[model samples]
Target chain A: MNVFVLFKKEAKEQVKTYRLLIVAAVFLLFGLSTPLLFKFLPEILEMSGEGIPIEIPAFTPSDALKSYVNSLGQIGVLVAVLVAMGAIAQERERGTIIMTLSKPVGFGEFAVAKLAALVVTFLIGVALGALACFYYTTVLLGSVDVQAFLAINLLIALYFVVCLSITLMYSAFFKSQLAAGALALVTLLVMGIVSSIPPLAPYMPSALMGWGQSLAVEGGGSAWPALIISGAIIVAAVLAAWQVLSRKEL
Target chain B: MTEAIVCKGLSKRYGRLLALDNLDLHVEEKTIFGFLGPNGAGKTSALRILAGLSRATSGKAWVAGEEARLNSSVLQRRLGYLPEDPAFYNWMSANEYLTFVGELFKLPSAELAARRAELLALVDLAGAASRRIGGYSRGMKQRLGIAQALMNRPAVLLLDEPCSALDPIGRLEVLETLVKLKEQKTTVFMSSHILADVERVCDVVAVIDKGKLIVQAGVEELRQRFAHPVFELEFDQPADSAIPLLQKVPGVTRVVTENRAGGVPVLRVHVTDTAKARHGLLHAVETSNLALRRYEIVLPSLEEVFVELVANHKEQSR
Candidate 1:
């Protein structure tokens, strides 16, 4: 119940600070620009050629979806992490958490509420951005399957949650937001790199994003296990953060 | 009297640094208790443990008969804490912040609104309730912090140096609000190094030094326990003449005199019993027909007691 109350407060704060709008705008720009960027790739290459033979991939509507997913997957994860990097660090640094924690609110409640609020905000931003990209891709190149668009978008959102969790956990554990943000960025980057190895590909959460993109493109490659693992990791990270934060002195 | 707060051998440590030693404290219901200590004297640590925001490394704390640990939500419900530097979400308006705090306490909607209005008026922030906290002056922010702390109508209010950060005028404002809170019968336990503030508002006082309690008692009791009564008198008599006459009084233990450059000689009479000394001195003055310009009993100040106790504690430890 306290979590819900805190969630409401956090939601209002996100709106007041224009963080909601900024995140939505960032996602929207990516969505609107990805299709346009990919659709004119051949023309763009031809115009800038200096006798360099660039073997461009076929720019189909599927490629447009791939570009959109990759864009959201990479830049969107960063946006999500950076946006939430200050969730707990700022409160602790500014000493606002002191009075709040003195209430009947638990560390878990505070953390979960913050995560829920940001997840909703990020989800809404991603949905709007994805819709814009989906519309432009359909009109410019060709039609995209509605089911695949929804499924792929959901997978990318899950990835965003993972990044958000990492950022928030560090924010609770570290005193400085910059340190937390850097650590989260490094952790995600390392995971992303390591998960690409052939042996680890099936078990890694990053593989879910690849599977989602592939399915959207050629309607193949299931990543159900990876999706479940990523979801589990997110939950674990949040719990660990709560435990650490509960032990923290002021 | 019912115990509003109790700490039994509470201790806190950070690695090798012992922030709080084994400490015991008791606060009765509806009393304004002042925790007096210099900076880094572990006052905040004790308050935080009682507030349930931090845990003691050893020992235990209780609030309103409930165990108070870091995760003790039940006890937390009955405790209102204002940290040394109370911080708020700068973007939030005062009304919004108070509402947020009320929501955390799970107050019902109707009661929450009513309480909010009452608290805003109590702290004199009703006019600026809609202004963002970031735009608020330090005093306004402090008042808002106090309002939020009282939103739950907590059984015990723990304030860590509420007036230490304010200007003189701002300090007076907060002190005034606290005075009104006292009338509401809230059990207020505040920590401060500012002796005058504590002396003004506190019914009970505890002096702590270097992770140890130097003394804890009612303000009047502490003064009586550690301070001696001394009376200062100004007359036309010289030091040699005044000393013998004052010393001859029955309850007067000793008398010393100092001659000012261009004024009358002053006599300080140390007394064993103030009542006996007062009667004897007045009788002697009247009988002698002494032109008494000034005769005043110098009651010991809390500052003197605090300094003596802390200095003695430091010397003993050394």
Candidate 2:
């Protein structure tokens, strides 16, 4: 119940701070542009007048959606880290954590409430982006497989959840937002590198992005290990943040 | 009286520096207790431990009959704490912040609303409750800090330098509010270095220096225990000649002449024995043929006792 109250406050803070607006705008821009860019690349390149005529294949919905997944995988991760890196560090720096935690708020509840609010904000952003992408792909290109599109977006959202939780954990560890953000980005970059190795691809969080791209381009293989591991990482990161905050001398 | 707050051998250390060294304190219910110390004297450290925001390296504390541990919801619910420099969400209005705090305590909706209004009015912030907190002055923020701490009517209220950011009028208002909390049987344990404010409202005070307890007693009792008796004498003429005679008197520890503007010189006689020094001082004045204008024994202020206690502690530690 206390978590509910804190969640409401955290959500309101996201809205009032314009973080929600910034996130939605970023996602919406990528969503609208990914399909439009895929459809008009030939014309755009011809206009550039490179002196040599290059052979361009016909644009497909799979190409547009796959590009969307890849764009979100790179730029979306940056947005997640930026949004969450200050969630705890800024509160501690400003002395607001002392005020909020001085009440009857459990450290776990405080951490979980923040994570839950961020999750909702990202979910909304992902939904809007997916809707725009779907609408554009159907209008400007061919129709997309609705189920595959939904699965791909869900995977993308889960990938972002992993990024946010890890960033929040670093935010709890350090008082400087810059340090937290840099460290979170480094950790995610390491994971992205590890996911490219064939032996470790199934176990890494970045595999979720690969899994989403595969769902969009191909048909049906499941990265069950990656899905389960991503879920575990999210839970573990939130719990680590809670433990760090509980022991901290706010 | 029941002890609303108690600490047994509480100590804290950061690396080689000892912030709090085996400090013990007992604060009774329904009293305004002052925790006085110089900067870095471990006053904030002890308060943080009692407030359950930080853990002590050793020893234990209890507030309102519950053990005070870091992040204990049960303990947190029973008490309220106001940090030295309270921060708020800049975008939030006073009304919004108070409502958010009240909800954190799980207060009923109707009660939360009424309590928010009452607290805003109590802090004289009702007129600007709707304004963003980012625009508030430091004094206004301090008052809001006080108001939020009292939202739950806590059994024990711990404040760290509650009035440090306030002006004279704001300080008086907060002091008066503390007095009212005592009347309502809420124990307020406030830490501050402002001796005059502590002297005015605190029923009991504990003075600490160098992370160790110097003295703990009632305000008047502290003055009585640690302060030396002093006599202020005004003479019709220069008392420079009388100083040597007064120094010769038994029980007179020190004597100094105070020069007043457009008036005759005065002598302050500090003594260990008031009775013997009183008689001897008068005899010494008469023998020197100095005509006395006024003679009065002055009670020492808390500032004097505090300075003496800290100075003596420093001397003894050396």
Candidate 3:
């Protein structure tokens, strides 16, 4: 119960600090960018008012949500990785870890609370951006199924959580805040690289993003197995980090 | 007397170095016990072991009548420790820090609030409770450390060199507070090399050297046992035959004279008993007409006692 209360307190503090501003900015950027890109593409092709043979696809509210997912599944998650990389690592850098560990709450609960904070931020950011992008895209194009769009938004949120969890584990391992942040960015870059290759692409975590994005765009074709597998990997990685942490001296 | 803490052959190794070497201790409840030692003398290690911050490599400890390893939670609830040079969450205010610790100990909301207020005032940080700890001075931070340690109103308080970082005024104020706790019958265990602080606050004292306890006894008793008092005399003129003459006296074990600066003579007379020896030496001084310039009793200080004990140990080992 105390751990839960501490978790809530930490959550509130996290929101007050740059988390809210960062989430809002990213969401707003995605919300405005999605509709503008869809609305102006045909006009841009007509620049110099020349005859262009290519035709733009029928824009819909669903397209906007899909666009946002692709953006977030890549850029949005990358931003989150940067913001959360030092979440635990900064504590160790500033030596607050010793101060906090002196308290009675076990280390697992402490780590769990921090991970929960990142997940909450991800949910709020993705949810707000999805809602905005839906409105603007609908006005520009036409109405679409809200359920499908929201489903895609939820997937983006979960993907963000998965990304944040990995960085949190790295933050727990590294002593320096800079190392944690750098390693997180490097790890994500390596994921992107490995998944882009021809032979090894299917086995990489980046493939999850690409695969999940396509399913989200097609509306309801996505199976739950890949998401569940990623969730399992997150749990296992966090557990391994926690085990190493349990034996670490202050 | 109720024993609050009992350790048997406790030891802890850090790589090749032994921080604690088969240390044993028995502390009585409701008493102020001072652990006196120089730096790197394993005082911190012993305190950490009791507080569950560090594990012991061998032997066992009973804290509050429970095995330290077996009942750490129950023991931790009772033992409040403030480490030497404690680092706090600089971003948090004193009130928030205390609240965090209080919640960790599972105090109810009302209880935590009230205790936080009381401890802040007790440590003279009431006005600064809302200010960030990063801005606090070294003395203020040390006080906050003590306040956080006392949040649970623990039964056994272990302060590791709590006054070491403090300025003179801060040290005096903290020493006064510690002594007040002693009067309240709190079982307080504090470690320091400052004998004056220990003498001012603790009723029982333990002298530690090289990770070993040199002596542990009541303050007055240890003074009586290990520390020897002697009377020294200096004269303008050296007594030509005073050594043999002084040795012939009933109480005098030996008489020695050595040259001091300015070619003056100094007398060192060791006797079996301080009071009886001073009496006989004074008598000899008067009868000999030795042109005495100064006569003073060199009652060994705690530092002197400490140095002598350590020196004797080294000599015996060599």
- Which structure among the candidates has the greatest lDDT? 2
Task: After superposing candidate 3 on the true structure, give the runs of residues whose Cα lies further than 4 Å from its correct spot.
Answer: A37-67, A186-208, B230-295, B310-318
Over A73-107, each residue of candidate 1 has an lDDT whose tens digit, in order, gives 88888888888889999999999988788888889
- Candidate 2 chain A lDDT trough over 10 residues, lowest sum: A46-55
lDDT of 3 by residue, A98-145 (tens): 555655656677778888877877777777787778787878867756
Lowest lDDT block of 10, candidate 1 chain A: A50-59
What value does the TM-score of chain B take for model 1?
A: 0.81
Worst window of 10 by summed lDDT in candidate 2 chain B = B256-265
Predicted structure 3: lDDT: 0.76
Candidate order by lDDT, decreasing, is 2, 1, 3
Clashes of each: 0, 0, 0
Which one is best on TM-score? 2
Looking at candidate 3 chain B, the ten consecutive residues that score lowest on lDDT are B66-75
Q: What is the DockQ of each candidate?
A: 0.65, 0.76, 0.27
Q: Which tens-of-lDDT digit does each residue in B1-318 have in candidate 2?
A: 899999999999988989999999999999999999989999999988888899999999999999989988899899989999999999999999999999998899999999999999889999999999999999999999998899999999999999999899999999999999999999999998788999999999999997899889999999889999889999887889889999999999888777889777778888989998888988998899988999999997898789889989999999
Every model's TM-score: 0.88, 0.93, 0.81
Candidate 1 lDDT, B89-156, residue by residue in tens:
99999999999988888889999999999999988899999988999887788878888999999888
